[model samples]
Target: MPTTAFSAHYSRELDVEQLGWLLSGDRPGDDQATVADLSQWAGWIRTDIRCSSCGKTGAQVVRPSKARGSQAVLRQAHFRFVDHQGGDGHHPFCEFYGNDTGEARQTDSLLNFGSEKSAETRAVRLLVCKGIETGLFNQATIRAMRQWFFDMKSESRFKVRATPEALAWARSLQRHPSYRRWTFHPAQAEMPAFDWQAAAKFQFTEENLALVELAKTVVHQDAEWKRAGLMAAKHFGQEVFNTAALQPYYEDTLTLCAFVAKNSGISFGKTSPDYYRFQGAPIPLLALCALMLFTSEWEMNTAIAKFARLLASAEPSDLSLGNMIGLNPFHDYAAWRLVILAAEVAERSLKGFDYQAQLTAIESDLRRQHAIWKSAG
Candidate 1:
């Protein structure tokens, strides 16, 4: 069983809570009719839902049945795989395979270990920072950390903070170590300064410059490009237009370049409105470049260059590229594929450690984490 599934219609993953909200006709901004009845909703889930990890259809959403004229709720809704004639089902690597219950228990326990101010939490944060600085952590460790951070935000019961220095180190390593949404948390509020400083000081090697030049010659209309742009804009609070007219505009790219150039100064800090305005521009561009890799017309050199620019922009500290790609490794098989492609590119072009092997290790660790949790449970 799984708590999250991907909805093809939305081009994004939705958790059981979001699905239940939609089925109750209370989804904000959703104009479509919803099935208020749990039974009907379960039928719809069978038809519409797919395993986020395996991308296989036939996953069913189960909600606690409401007694006639009663209001008490007993349990939360979740997704479970249904039996099919063929062996087509969740992949062996899927986190939900025979370990959902234990995984959930372990995740909850780990997340609730301490509060933001506790010594335990601080020790963990320091360990993460040290691991990043010394290159002691691999892709598996990074993936585990990313999962922990993501669950902290989504689950609502846990709230943890990472120092700006820790976040900067994580970003320098091309790993996202924060949540998707920026809140009023003090630590989060203080991050833009560190992010801007890192971006301004970003050094582009000769190879990086050449790759950027190469990327300029490659351009084509990919639907994923538009979707990436729209989602990025939505994430950063930028105005979005209709998808029909949303293509990669030269002006937007130029604007991004200009923003990078102008803000690449020592004086620009969090207080500057422009810092807030363009701090997040690179993320969408990175998303675009990542999606391009999946298209038939992808260019490896071009992707490497775009990824370089994303690093120079420095706004990715608060957002996960995996999440922006909408193929979280825990839920979507495509995420593993994307990681493999990205690892290959990074190995050849990007600086840092053996990210190629490290990225692949994320899948292994995800499986291992489930097994450990199941055994402990």
Candidate 2:
């Protein structure tokens, strides 16, 4: 049986041994220190710690770079190795050089943050490794997610909206000597240049994972089957139009239409109408909750609560709002509709609804409605 494990390079092993020196900013070579001993140390671990093996400076221990005290201590308790800038500087024959000593196979070790790769690629790899380390997802599943994200890139050119806070953080890192060193590489070195700034902008947290999950889910169009057919779309328009004129119940039809336009990527370009009217928008917050419901029937309440937190904490770029709004009418509609849905679902709970049963019923109705539209047309 091939157990899944992260690779342990010589540099990481050296970092583990020199935890005392790394934390204290002293000389290296405490390879004998135990995890319990490092845990008991009171000082903080700096990002500019030198490698014990190769004397290479700028090795980052897998600690909470932004956290402090006990929280940082807790985070750094494990000795998972992250990539250092440029390279690990180990001799070619060193046991840790490009080594896959972790429980996982050699192939699984391909997603290395330390390698000379693009910042976007490193960010993706970081997410996968963090997901595996934290039990947010399995390695295999995250690998699939990584592949999906790469495959779906459109010439459309997407840029995440950066908040003031994100920008400030990036600025602070740019000013720091350690981070500056890590971000910059000797131009003529064999190492590939990377965007360290971009990597630093994304954290391997639950909120980021949700954002990534949304991107992956939207691109995959997993909900395509539930989308309204041409007839269904026309019929839905007709029904909404009639109801809007006749009753308050039908008033939500316009809102629903608007939601479809915004959340279904209409602003970006042409997209299926079924996205908005029949299947519902895969809004990052809502889609995350919905995915949880589909995967784990018992965790419904937890998923709903998680959705609420994600919605509240979300940044505009986190939801892809920048790309979906302000460029055209589609953008305007999507931006507004997302605001509307957020208000509507803010305090709701999922306890009363059997989501599995509801999904099955909705899918059936969609097929029937689409068929009716086709026949009438």
**Superposed model 1: Cα runs more than 4 Å off:** 1-3, 8-13, 17-24, 29-39, 62-78, 82-96, 105-327, 330-377
Name the best candidate (by TM-score). Answer: 1
lDDT of 2 by residue, 64-103 (tens): 2224453222222223323444444433322133432332
- Decoy 1 TM-score against native: 0.27
Model 2, position 197: C-alpha lDDT score: 31
lDDT of 1 by residue, 52-98 (tens): 54566777655433345864333334466654653435554344444
The worst-scoring run of ten residues by lDDT in candidate 1 lies at: 108-117
**Pairs clashing within candidate 1:** 52-331, 52-332, 53-331
| TM-score of every candidate | 0.27, 0.18
lDDT score, candidate 1, position 27: 48
